[model samples]
Target chain A: MPIIVNLDVMMAKRKISSNELADIVGITAANLSVLKTGKAKAIRFSTLDKICEALDCQPGDILEWQNPAEKT
Target chain B: MWNKHRSLKLSRILVLCFSVMIFMMTFFVPFVADWYEDVSDGMGLIGGSVYVPMMVTLYVCEGLAVWAVAELHILLKNISKGEVFIERNTRCLRCISWACLLAGGVFGVMALWRFLLFLPAFFAVMFGLIMRVLKNVFEQAVEIKSENDFTI
Candidate 1:
């Protein structure tokens, strides 16, 4: 529960549209939105590699571990 | 052409109709004295507690067969419409339909095998038919599924 997808924040800082990111990352806009908003149950490493390469960020920049998090 | 699809549906309806008719015939026929006890003799239920339960079970099995046919019709139509692009869903439905028919045929054959002298060869044949129809249903469903998956 504490792990977070910081895709939206990173996208905002990078001035990138979800659609643009999806185009570069080779996935559907809907699936991209699923990953961005943290609704996805799990991420494939291949997808993760594509996303990280497209965003030019470390995996930690996209994923954050937070304390005081309730268990899902 | 009037069509095999329509014929199969008609046959399913007829099976249900005949089951009810047989129950009524067993009920009204005067040679049969007791309602629950004697009906088994006519239906070939033997000395066990199978008479009333068998009649009741025919109704239930036929009811389920009707529902299964309806669902198979929908799945067939789905395959026709290109709606069932997902191979997983299509495959599962095909497997289920096959399973239903397999069980139906096994039970039907068992029924005839048990009551060979008393019951006619018709139920055995009907069960054979259910198996055949279900096989066709599965094949057609899979055919369209493969075609559509390739298209997609």
Candidate 2:
């Protein structure tokens, strides 16, 4: 889990609700919650594409890599 | 007629019937002894005193087989309910394998006393080993299934 999902931060930056983003991205809100909470083991490229298109952002904006030993 | 459910049901029924037969036979030990005395007198296979020891060995092995069949009943019920590759089934298989091994060991020891018991002892131990292998497979399958479930 060195890779982190910054979905919440990006969603906040764009001022979009979870339900609205899920609808626009054509995924269930529960799956969106799993992604947001970093419970998903993988993200398909198609799903990532839909998410990026819906949020008007790049994949890099929503994902980040941080060393567990480093304090953010 | 050839469906998995039907096949499983048939297997369950057969196991249940065999269990019941063993249960009934345990009660007929004295009669079996009399019959054996009559039949084996010509062949001189076993003497009258040996029947008691044979009865004891048979009863102990039957007890183990009965317990194993009960485990099979639980396993079949779970499979029928669509609960394959679970820990409970794995435990059931382990119990059955141990029961078979114990029964086989008892019969094998009895064979030292009576040479006629060798065949059953050999088959029982072989079946037990097979069951042990099956239990290992189920254990691996359960691990893979749990990992798959958690992947999402």
Off by over 4 Å in 1: A1-3, A65-72, B1-55, B79-152
Q: Write the residue-wise lDDT of candidate 2 on A1-72 in tens digits.
A: 898999999999999999999998888889899889988777778889988998899999998988988956
Q: Which lDDT tens digits does candidate 1 get at residues B1-152?
A: 79866766676576567556655654453333235444434334434554444455455445555555555555556545545544544544554455455445545543542464223335444554666565567567767655543320
Clashing pairs in 2: none
Candidate 2: CAPRI quality band: acceptable
Per-residue lDDT of model 2, residues B63-131, tens digit only: 888899899999999999999989999999999999988988887776665566777888989999999
| Whole-model Cα lDDT of every candidate shown, in order | 0.60, 0.84
List-wise, what DockQ does each model earn? 0.04, 0.28
Best candidate (score: lDDT): 2
Clashing pairs in 1: none
Give the winner by DockQ. Answer: 2
